[model samples]
Target: MMSEKILEVKDLVVDLDLDLGDGRTRPVLSNVSLSVSDSEVLGIIGESGSGKTVLSRALVNWVSHPLRVSNGSILYRGQDLLTLPPARMQALRGRKIAYIGSDPGSALDPTLPIGRQIVEKLRSVEPGISTRDAAARVVQVLDAVRIPSARERFYEFPFQFSGGMMQRVMIVDALVTNPDLLVADNITQPLDVTVAAQILRLLQDLQRDFKTAILFVSSSLGVINEIAHNVLVLANGRVVENQSVGQLLSTPQHNYTKHLIADIPRIWKGGPDTAAPAPAAAAPEMEPILSVRDVDRFYATKDREKLFGKQIVQAVRGVSFDVYKGDNLGIVGESGCGKSTLSRLLSCLEAPDSGQILFKGQDIANMKAKELLTLRRGFQLLLQDPYNSIPPHLTIGRTIAEPLLIHGVPRREVHDRVTATMHEVGLSVELYDKLPVGLSAGQRQRVSIARALVLDPELLILDETLSALDQVEQSKLLALFDRLQAQRGITYIYISHDLGMVRRACNRVAVMYLGRVVELANNERTFFDPGHPYTRALLSAVPAIEDRPYKAETYLLEGEPPNPINIPPGCSFRTRCPFAFDRCATDDPRLRVRGLDDLAACHLQEINVPAE
Candidate 1:
C-alpha cells in the first residue's frame, strides 16, 4: 500500500556562486528528483563533498547566500515550496517541517532548560498555545523518545545530558510540533553504536506514531539500511541511484554505491578491509611495550546541590591491560565509558590516582620531568577533529615540522624530514606552504598523521581519530596506518566507539563499560565468542549490511550507562544487562580468565552461560 506523496522534488538544480571576477556559478546539485510519501523514511547516502547536506538544506528552502536553487520544484502537498512567499515559508518551516542536525550539544540554548527551549519553539509555531500546555506537550514527546525521567529532566540544561540523551532531546524538539516532515542531517554520526541503534528505533516509532516523513541523511550505509525504507544514493550532488533498501543492498545499480557498500567494515565476515591479524603465538611470548596495572583516576567536582561539598568522579576505575609490541589494540565503548580517560593515561597526558602505567618496564607516574619528556618522544596522540587539531595559521609543512623542531632537529634537515613524512602519509608536496583553509577532511587528517609521525614515534594513540572522516577517507587512513606499521613497526592504540572500525582495524579489542574494562580478548574471540554480556550488547547494536552475530532484540541495551559520578554497586553493567542475575547485583565481578587468552568481568563466567 503506497502512501500518498507528502513532498516531491523535480529536476532540482542548485548552484554555488563563485566570487571570481567572471561571475561564474557552479552547479552543486544537478537534475535531482525524489519523492517522499507519508510515514516514509527516505535516506540520502553519500560520502563527504557529495552535496548531501546541501540537498537536505535545499529541500527545506533554507539554502542561504552563495548557494541558490537555480532550477527546481519542491512541491509539498501540491504546493510549490520554492516559489512560496517568505512569510508563508517561515510559517511552514517549524509548523509543517522540522530539521535536526548532527551536533545536538550546540543545537539548543545552553543557558535555558531543555524543556523550556522546546516549549518556546512550540509557542512560536502556535502563538495561541499557553506556556503550560506547551511544556506538557514537550514532556510527553520527551517520554515518547524514551528519555528517562522526562519531567524532572525537563528542567536540566543541555550539558546535564550525555551525547545520546542530547540527541534524543533534539528529536523531541523537532517532534514537538508534530510536523509533516523531518530532515535529519547526520544526526547519528557522532553517537556510539548502542545509542545510534536506539535512535534508529526511536525514529521508526516516531514515524509510525506521528505519521511523519523523514529525510535521514548519513554517510554510513549501515545506518541507512537500519532506518531507511527507500535509499537514495547521491554522488557529487547528483542523484546516482534510488531504490528500495532491499534492492540497494542486495544489488546496487551504481558503481559509486557498490564502492560504498564495499568500503563498509564487516564484523563477523572476512573482507578486504579487515585488519591483518597479529601472530597469535608470538604475542604471548613477546614482552608488552605498554602495560596498565590496576590504574585508577578520579576527579573532584563541586556538588550541584551543595556548594561546600564535592563529588568524586571515578573516570577510570581499576583498569588494567597489556599492549604487546606491534599490536593494533582497540579500546571501544560508549561515551563517558572511560576510553578517553584511559587514552590520556596511556599517553601520559595525566597521572593516574593509583597503580602504575609501565611503558617498556618504566613506571610513567614515577618518571621525573626530564625523564617523562624523553619518554613522550616515543609516543604521540592524534585527536578526533582534524580541523581543530591542526593549527589553522600554520602551513601544512610547518605543522608537520613543528614536532621535529620541538625535538631540536636541525633547521636544515627539518624540511626534508617533514616533506618525506608528508609524502609517506599520502599528502602532496605541493601542499607544503598551503594553510589548512581549503583542505578537505581527509587531507587535514593526513596532515595530522604526518605531524604525529614526524618524530618517528614507536607508539601512536588515536582517540577517535578516524571517526570524523567519511568511510572512504577512513579506509584510506586505515590502509595508510597498515602500511606505516609494516614499514616502521609502529604500534597503535585506537580508542573509539565505532565497532565496525574496531572489527576491521584491531588485532585485540578491549570493551569498556562505565569506566571499567569488562572484557578483553583477541579479535576473533571478541567478535565471535564475546565473554561478557556488555560486549555482546555492543556487538548487537552495531549497524551493518550483513547479519549481526548478536541480534539486537536479545542484546541491545535500553538506556545509557548509569551516571559515572554515582556508579552503581556490584557489577557496573548489571543495571543494563538483560542476563543479569541476583548475584550480579549483590557482588561485583572481577576480570578473570574466561577462555583461552580471554578475560571477562561477569558472574556468568562462573556459570554455564548459554551462547548466542
Candidate 2:
C-alpha cells in the first residue's frame, strides 16, 4: 500500500513587496514543487537566499508582511491550505504542523520559564490536559531531546541556558504537541559538531518512536545525507534537482548542485602537508608579527542577584603562542574553549590580566590610544553574523567608509577606497545606497569584507566569520581570503569550529580545551595524527562523506565541558580524556614537542603511548 501524502507544494511562487514608489513585487521563489509522504523525511538543500527558508514558510501559509505566496497550492492531508479559513489554519499550525525556526532564541520567551512556555504549548493543543500533566509532558519531551535534569531545567528561564541547551528546549517545545509534520529549519546551524551530532541522533530516535513525517531544511549536505531519505536542491528560488540522498550526493545532475557538493571542504585530508603536493621550500626570514605570552583573562560573574554568590570565570588562562607576519593560524575548539576571548586579546580589543601581547615588539596595553588607533587600522575583526556585524540602518557606502573616515583619510580617498574595496569583494556599485536588510547573507558578508579591506588591514581576525554562511558563499569567501592574502601578504587568525575550512585555509592549527591550547601543530599533523584526545573527538564528530554505516561518532567525551566558573584541578581536559589516569588528575601537562613543529599537552604522549 502506498503511504498517504502529508503535505504537497505545487508550482509554488512567492513574491516580496519591494515597497518601491511604484509598488512592484519581486519573485523570491518560482515554480517550486515537492511533497512529503507519511513518516517520510523531505530535505530542502540550498545556498543562502535560494528560497529554501521562504518555501518552508510558504508551505504553512505563514509568509510574513511584504512576502506572500503569489501562486501555488499548498495541500495538506488532501486539503488546499491556501484556501483554508484563518481560524482553521491557526488550529492546524501549532497542533498538527509545528515550526522550530533556525534561531532558537526567537522561538522562546525571555520572561517566562522554559517549562511554562512548553506547558502552555501543550495546554493550547490539548485543552483538557491538566497543568500538572502538561508540565510532566514538558519534562518528558525535554528528557527525550537530551536536556539533562529536564524536570529541574523546566523552571529555569531561557537566559540561563546555553545556545545548545536553548536549542534542545526549542525541540522539546515543538514536539510537546506531537505535531504530525515537524518543520525543523536549520536547527543545528549554530551548534558545535558534537552537539549537532547529538541533536541529529535525538531526531533520529524521535522519528523512530513517533513515526512523524518531517521536513528537514538545511544547507549542510553532510547533515542531509545522515538524516533525509530524499533531498530537493534549490537555487535562485527554483528547484534544481530532486533525488534520493544517495543518488543526489553521488551523482548530482545540475551544475549548481554539483558546485554545492564539490565546495564542501574535506576535513584534514587536502592540506598541503597531507595528500596534496607540498609547496616549494618556504621563506624562512621573519620576525613575529604578534607574540602572545602567558596571557590570562578572568571574567567575574555579577553575583549580586544570585542566591549563592558571585563566581570568577577563567575565560583564558596563561595562553601563549606566536603568529608570524604572513601566517594563517587556525584555532579549532568547541564554543566555550576560550578561542573567541583569545581572539579578542590578539586583536587588542581586550586587555589581559597578566602576560605580554607584543605587536611588532610593542605592548598592546602600553600603547597610547592614538598609537593603538594607528595599529588597529592594520588588523580588523570579521564576526560570524554578517547581519549583526554591520549596522542595519547604515547605507553600504557609509558603512564601508566609516573606518576609512575614522582613520583620518581624505574624504575623496575614503570614497575611492570604499568603491574599490566593494568591487574587489564582488558587490555591485548600485548597492552602495541600500540598507543591509535588502542584501543576502553573502552580500552582507561581502560588505563586511569590503569594510574591513577599505582600511587595508594587514591582519584579519576571523571569529567564525563563515559559520553562518552557506557552502557556496563560504567557498567564494575562502577564495577571496586566499586572494587577499596572496596579493597583500596579509595574515589571518581564524577562530572556527570548521576543521575542514581551517585545514584548507591555514598552514598551522591550535586545539584549545577549557581555556588552554591543548595541541599546536601544522594543520595536517594536528588532524591526521592528533595527540590530544579532545582534538580526536572533535574530528570524529564530523559526518563522513562516504557510505559507511553512519553511527554517530562521539569518540569518548562523556559530558559537556566543566563550567568555567569552577574548573577542575590539574588538567582541564582530563575529565573527558579516555586514557586519563590518576597522574592526569594531579599533574597538568604542558605542551611538549611531538614533532619538529607539532606540540601536544597529554600524559599519553609523554609516556610514549600512541593514541588510537
Those runs of model 1 whose alpha carbons end farther than 4 Å from true positions after fitting are 270-275, 279-285
lDDT of 1 at 112: 98
Give lDDT per model, in order.
Answer: 0.90, 0.84
lDDT of 1 by residue, 309-340 (tens): 99999899999988877888999998999999
Error of 1 at 525 (Å): 0.7
Alpha-carbon lDDT of model 1: 0.90
In model 2, which residue pairs have backbone atoms overlapping below 3 Å? none
Tens-digit lDDT track for model 2 on 1-612?
A: 898889988999899998897979999999999999988888899998899888888877798879988898989988898999998898898789988888988777799999998888788878899999999888889888877788888899998887778888888888888878988999888888777777777788887788788999998988898789999999999999999999998888999998888888776444345322222223466667788899999987877458877789999988888888778888988878998898888888889999999887889966789999989887889989887899988999999999878888989777777888998889998888888886888888899989999888888899999999988888899889888887898888989987767877887888998899999988668767788888888877775464321123436354479889879988888787776889989889999999977899998999999766
Who wins the TM-score comparison? 1
The TM-scores of all predictions, comma-separated, are 0.98, 0.94
Global fold similarity of model 1 (TM-score): 0.98
